[model samples]
Target: MAVPLLGEHLLFTLRSPRLPTHAGQVSFPGGVVEPGEGVVEAALREAEEEVGLKGVEPLGFLSPTYSPQGFLVQPVVVFREDLPPLKPNPEEVAEILLAPLGELLEVEPWSEVRLGRIVWHFPWRGVDIWGVTGNILKAFLEVWREGKSPPHELL
Candidate 1:
């Protein structure tokens, strides 16, 4: 999920060292949906739990992406006029990062063929956002830049 903060910045989280997978990696605040929870509900709940973010309006959902680790992720876009003070959960989140959207857009994506497939990486500061997160951001920027939906097949 993407959280648009005040000043057009995007919110991200650094996973805690205690995480089983992707530990210490940078990602948007989100997790698996529970049996009775919807995508938006799961996204919001995770956001609040991981970063103490609240009172955001749901903009829309991006295309679902399948992770290499065997999970489907739905990127939910949300907006807030301003962000509240954050208290990151130590167990799930190590730190909260607010990155400017324009700066992120300007960074060139690093790509290479790995295991017979192309993988893209976006390095922001010291965080390397790759895998599913990078793909989602690429798709979001593509739509934002073109001002139209991406190819349905691409989604």
Candidate 2:
């Protein structure tokens, strides 16, 4: 998965309700790696395909993330200083969201027990970010919690 950061905001996609899985839910842009493509390549490609994002530079990679559905997803960080116009692919994306990274980092997510496991929900605006996407964001925040800088060259 590619987490596109524009300055201090993170880019997210609202999945189209017509989709089969995770429909109408918010998540980062990502898809399966192609025949000879690497994780970073797949991430950038998926970002472009799903949200019309282009020319972003990869910043770093986080630990592999696994969804409750048992899919292994590699998370990659990408960034662009200036805000870029985003066009959502109507078939896959309903809307594009820009989340305030500072607010997300400052607020603690609420949690609940679900299926014998603790699930966290990060509230933003009027929406709740949970499930796989929530887990990914939570893990990413761990870096800051540990007082470790993210794999970045420059903002």
Candidate 3:
């Protein structure tokens, strides 16, 4: 999930040391959906749990992507009127980074592995964002740039 603040910045989290997977990596505040839970519900719940984020209004959802680990991730875009004082849960988050959307938009993919495969990396502060999280940001920016609504296939 991406949280857009009033300053045109987006929120990202550094994974906690306690996490089994992707520890210390940069990611959005989200996790696996539990049984019987919808994607939006799960995203909201995880955001609240991991970052104490509240009062956000959902803008839309980007196209879902499958992780290399085989989990389907639905990226939700949300808006906040202003930046909130975040209380990150130490067990799930190490630090919160607010990146300017303009900088993110200006970033070119760091590498192109194949004809259709491009690899992106965004380094904010000292942390690098890549892999699935990077892909999510790239897709979201594309949709935003085109001024098109998020794909209806998202749910």
* TM-scores, each model vs. reference: 0.87, 0.89, 0.84
Tens-place lDDT digits, model 2, residues 53-149:
9989898887886676768888898988768888999999999999877788986698776555556689898888887788778877776566664
Instruction: List lDDT for all candidates, in order.
Output: 0.77, 0.83, 0.74
Q: Which candidate comes out best when scored by TM-score? A: 2
Candidate 3's residue-wise lDDT over 34-75, tens digit each?
899888778888898998988887777878876556567888
Model 1, runs deviating above 4 Å = 2-6, 113-118, 148-155
TM-score winner between candidates 1 and 3: 1
Over all chains combined, what TM-score does candidate 1 have? 0.87
* Candidate 1 lDDT over residue span 87-144, tens digit each: 9999999999898878888989987655544557899897898777777777777766
| Cα lDDT over the full model 3 | 0.74
